[model samples]
Target: MKIKTLIVDDEPHAIEIIETYVGNFPEIELVATCNSAIEAFQILQKDRIDLLFLDIKMPGLLGTELVRTLKNPPKVIFTTAYQDYALEGFDLNAVDYLLKPIPFNRFLKAMEKVFDGYRPINRQIVSVQTDQNKSENFIYLRVDRKTVKINVRDIYWLESLKDYIKVVLADRTLVSKQKISVLAELLPESLFLRIHRSFIVAVDKIDSYHSYAIEILGKELPIGRNYKDACRQRLQN
Candidate 1:
């Protein structure tokens, strides 16, 4: 079943961009675009929406406020120009938070997380068919409006910045709006380990380590207390 989606934003151009991006994914169907929270609330009363693209700074009855009143809110991806609301958005268990002028790649990555959340319930339908077709040496990442190819071996580590992750390579870094947990699943388990809640270090990238931190690429990353035992065992190998 396609995910029923709603785009709630005051800007016509913003709604248009999201409508265009939603078309790229076959699993999502655009239901409606409301210019205000009041209109969106009315639509919600009559429609069953699975995903929501919300703008937090709407004039009255703010997007955040609208979600606060919903007993069972749909998975939300906040698209706005302001960055301050990111922490609050995640506190509401939002699927993703995006900053504007939203890039298509970021939009795609956010949809990926939304799809990942529904994967268990709709496993057969939501699972990426490319997983079966692709080889182990490389992976596809939604980076800047295109699904860019990356060699897994070139990745030094992954740093999580709340709603996004930085893929550190030897020469450059690629940032994508993907959760750390989601990105971790894409990486080969044997070669990667979550040393901290916000960090994933390549097994071969470790230069040295103590009980407190693991050194990678001349930088020391703290080992989360909960992840200490696992990090110790994995890095020692």
Candidate 2:
């Protein structure tokens, strides 16, 4: 799917470079270009901008402020020369942050984030599929044709095997040959979250979290290198 995007940066050369790079991707279509956040905001009000390539430093307003001002902002990817704003970017759930003087490969990664901005493709988009036919809170585990019904609440944590996942519960671990990404959606969002590419854990099930791992039922699970901050914040709350 083509992503309609906007570029908002103070530097004319920076905007030119971005426009040139964005032209390289078949999936990306530049919708608007603005030198300031206010101009971008006006454009956003009139156009359907799907993604934003925002710059941190600008004359009247900072890029982060522009994002905060929007009631329903599009997906944002902060573009800046300084690496200091990385924490702020993630706090806003930015798709990805692009360092200034963006190389083609790095730009490619940012473009790929279009996939990440939304839900993982396999899981159905949440909707009002309610009432008599409410979505079941259980997933069927293929246990040799005798499918076992596993309640989402019972899942404490899951570890990735070479070809499957070991669903760790208080009682016992059940084996699931499902991708962690897909299984993530099957569970309740408030209860479970993907702390790593390989691990999924119940938010409420966490007993104590440390700098390295979270201790659950005396079992410690390694926090994925990049996902530590998000997990720590969530666990603390």
**TM-scores of all models?**
0.52, 0.48
Computed on alpha carbons, the lDDT of every model, listed in order, comes to 0.81, 0.75
Q: After superposition, how far is residue 88 of candidate 1 from its true place, in Å?
A: 0.9
Clashes of 2: 0
* RMSD for each of the candidates: 12.6, 14.7
Deviation in Å, model 1, residue 64 alpha carbon:
0.2
lDDT over C-alpha atoms for residue 24 of model 1: 54
Instruction: Give me the candidate number with maximum lDDT.
Output: 1
| Local accuracy of candidate 2 as per-residue lDDT tens digits, 1-237 | 567999999997788667655654445678889999999999999999998999988999999999999999999989999899899988998988988666544565666666665544442211222232233455545444334556667778987886677888789878855555545545666777677788888888888888778878988888898888888787777
For candidate 1, lDDT tens digit of each residue in 24-98? 565678999999998999999899999999999998888999999898999999999999999999999999999
Best by TM-score: 1
The positional error of residue 219 in candidate 1, measured at the CA in angstroms, is 55
